[model samples]
Target chain A: MPPPLKAVLADDEKSLCVHLKNLLQQAWPELQICAEARNGVEALEMIEKHHPDIAFLDIKMPGMSGMEVARRAADMCRIVFITAYDQFAVQAFENEAVDYLLKPVEPERLARTIQRLKERFEKRDLDPAPIQAVLKSLQGRLAAAAPPPYLKWIKVPDRQSLRLIAVEEICCFQAQDKYTVVQTEREEFLIRKPIKELVDELDPQTFWQIHRSTIVNAAWIDKISTSLTGSYVLTLKRRPGTFTVSRGYRDRFKSM
Target chain B: MMKTGNKLQTPCDSVRQKDFKPMSPTLRQHRKGLSWKDLGLTALFSTIIAALLTYVFQDESFWVYLIISQGIGLSICTLCRYSLALFNPQTSWGIVAVVATASIFGGMLGGTVGAWLSGIEMPIFLSKKIYTLRVLIMSLLFGSVIAYYFFSRERLSEIRGLLQEERIQRLTSEKHAVQSQLKMLQAQIEPHFLFNTLSNILSLLDSDAARGKTMLRDLTRYLRASLAESRSQWSTLGSEMELVGAYLNIFKIRMDERLQVHIEMDEALKEIPFSPMLIQPLVENAVIHGLDATIEGGTIHIRAEQENGLLRITVADTGQGIASVPSPGLGLANIRERLQALYGGRGRLIITENQPRGVKAVIEVPYATAP
Candidate 1:
């Protein structure tokens, strides 16, 4: 009775775009594929020209991504993300209140997405609250997805040859006078890096700030025992000395 | 030590003082045997009270009457304190009840004994009303004072214990929350590149089966190696190289021969330990930013060597060199952060221009062998 639902499909892969278009044609006979874009840039232009009712977009494209296209053309049409990410990674979309179809789109899953879109069109209800929430959640996920810098290796100076130490091998670091003493299971080395700076660089989960002068590897810790005076003593599995956990840093061992 | 004249006297009924010392429940119920200190303190206090009463009564045996009265009063006060301590009663009502009962009982017993000891022939109740009332008032004062002291002492200690327990509980929960949050963040590894590569492989499967199979094999190898290496915090240099090899295989499938990688690792350093997922990011950066930009693909040369007490790694690509020192992106920034965390100031990353063209990234860390 109503005019056919018009939609735009965008994907960098021509094969995938064609495949999705065929699937859509088979699932909903009344639907019209008004535009097909090979990339995000093309998709944006097509949306501006056609002003379609729905846009199916691949999340990652060559120059721009589906998320970017959604942001620019959000007011014009409803957006559905196409992604290759696993279910765990795609949980971000659920939080954003956005609809997403996983890669190698199945008929059953596509039908569900179509059903929801059809209901929204029939009701003529376009609420911006969920779209706003999705945008905020998308920003958060992007920030989290941005990988932070981490240490790869350490250069330790030995007697004759300069030794390369893996950061993970060092069991603990103790600050002495002006230098930090880096200890592994077998030997100890001195470095100019202060305990304070090392604390910032090391992974907080693996290397705990147990004492003011000591940053210990959680894996290397043998056991933590409370002394008669209520102070905590941390013993390392492969090392000789027992480190004293100061009152201020005792909270790190609160679970123990 | 009963006196000859006091033999005919109604034997002074002295209540046993129950002491509340920290002990096992079984031991707590059994009172500690009277000690020499207890006897001496009681004797001294009784003597003092007797001397004062003698001045007031002006009787021949006024000292004996005061001694009996003082002894009974001290015993009742001590008993009340012990009962209240054992029960751990919080209400003011409990204290009031203990004091009221102890005072009444002590007043009657002590007044009767003191009157008989003072050689009063008649019953004390039948004697002068003022004398009996004075004895009762004296007993009440001593009993209440000692009972009140014990009650307040217990209340103060209980409050202190509660405050200490509350502090420990709050700190423990806060630490647990922080540790779990760190774990959650660490577990969420960004798999953006991985999924994209997978999608490419899926498209290639139907179009070019042979290439898809090769890419799938490489992807499997990469996943297996990476997953195994990530289980532990450390990995060998040999294993890290293999992981890079696997990663390059997947990238080569997408880029074809456009991405050429040549790796030179010192045979001696193969046995040396390295952190997992370290140098791979640098190689990735070289490919994505450097080689991807050039018209024709460029070669990435990766070399590692042991210098004077330090290990040096260099990744150079033959692509268009940057005009200026550009700000570090996610990959370079990640490497910098990781290096800073591992070696503090000792760990260094130096970026420079290659001889002909492209950018060269050098990483240096202390050379230490695995135990």
Candidate 2:
């Protein structure tokens, strides 16, 4: 048999990297793991130095993105992308025509991708047209779509199931202990997400920046009224309705 | 109204004018002033005391009878009224005390003759010691009753006023808090959005210049929408979806083929109003933490449905699942807090391991109509 296909694995997650390496060794004992890289730049360097026949690339890395590395390494070796993203990037992958594996790297999927890579190597015809089209479509979608920064709903753990909460139904989001709470019209649920991350994605129009630790739904606002104690308080249109906006956020109501 | 006139005409009014003292004290003192009922009760008690004294002194000289009768009646009546004013400041007790004092004194004094004629000595018939004790006790009891009646009536009115004031204060504070918080939450959404979008734009500038131009236009639309309602707290679901679509596109550029997104929403719920930016963060988390960490790209499915009286939205990814590092990223946490602030106890977010693998984030909120 032609000398076992030389390969390299690149990923930031140590456990996953090891798992994939083991799986590869099991599938093709002769396949040599020439080098391992933890990031895109390192992966690129290793590919350049070792000239591996095949490379498994993780899309996101600290130094350089997997795509950036792939773009640079496109002519040098066959690339198989491994990632956890969705269809929005499918076009980009398709444009590359590079074999890709979804995360949790199923053995069967890995085997198929490897088989395809080997077949392409033998044929010596790695067409970049499909990849180019996919990339174009992805870019088109990104350009045309409007980004909603806010989260409209969240899925929470329930009894053996999950609960979906509409963001509008929420009155306030409060950080408590280690978890953030989603307070709504009927109940409250605890979730393990950071406040900063939520702030990044929420829509600016409906969610108000009340304090460092709190975000309020603007629709729930009844009015801005001064407390007898000379502080600002928020009144909700709902029952048992009142929340204090910290002094730091007082300036936020200038327009209101 | 009549009592108020007397207060305004009083010498204290002149003092108030000169001092420019707060009106609260004067108003309170005025409220404590005696009314018609108090005066009537005082007069009745005085008369009964006078009559009793006169009856007791019937065998004594007229001068003695007159002196004792006038002295006791006047002294007791004046003292009872002053006591009513001082002790029962709340008014209800004052009324009860005044009325009770008058009734007891009048009944005892008026019935003395009947007891004397029933074969009993004038002093022994009413039992001088017992009569005196009874008079004192009855006078006190009646005085308290009078004071209580007046006190209760005044107290009820005062309580009503206080309740009204409290209600206003409560409403005012609540309004302010809501406004401030709304502003804060609104403020928090834009910066991160701009940052992420700008990053997307940067990425697109290199690979596809035409797409970058289009993305810039979309960004402008998003910015316009965000600025259009710097003060609005709610938006149509359709508009929010449009915003999410834009955000997803930006991610699509950064993530390239490693990310797949699917949005499944009920057509009927599309018109419903929801918190803006409510769905975008979950999708972001799926891309950044869930899918970004994996070597191979995965699918992010966002599904919205109306079940029971609630709206259920799910963001699921076939990614690396929760990080093995035992800590979650910040995006999911922030989304949860925003939900809580908007819904209080009504909203919920659930996170679980998706079928086969990956993570699923679900949010549920009561269906609310636009105000």
State what share of the real interface contacts each candidate retains.
0.08, 0.03
lDDT of 2 by residue, B87-201 (tens): 4332343355454565455445533532443334676645677555534543454445444555575777778755654554444444443444354346435453454455445
Residue-level lDDT tens digits of model 1 in A82-137? 98775643676687557788877778999999998899899986665665566666
lDDT of 1 by residue, B300-361 (tens): 89898999989888888887654322333424545555565556568877666665777677
The candidate maximizing DockQ is 1
RMSD of each: 19.6, 19.8
Q: Alpha-carbon error at B223 in model 2, in Å? A: 2.2
Candidate 2, which segments miss by more than 4 Å at Cα? Answer: A1-158, A162-256, B1-129, B132-196, B275-299, B315-371
Candidate 1 chain B, run of 10 with poorest lDDT: B19-28
Best by TM-score: 1
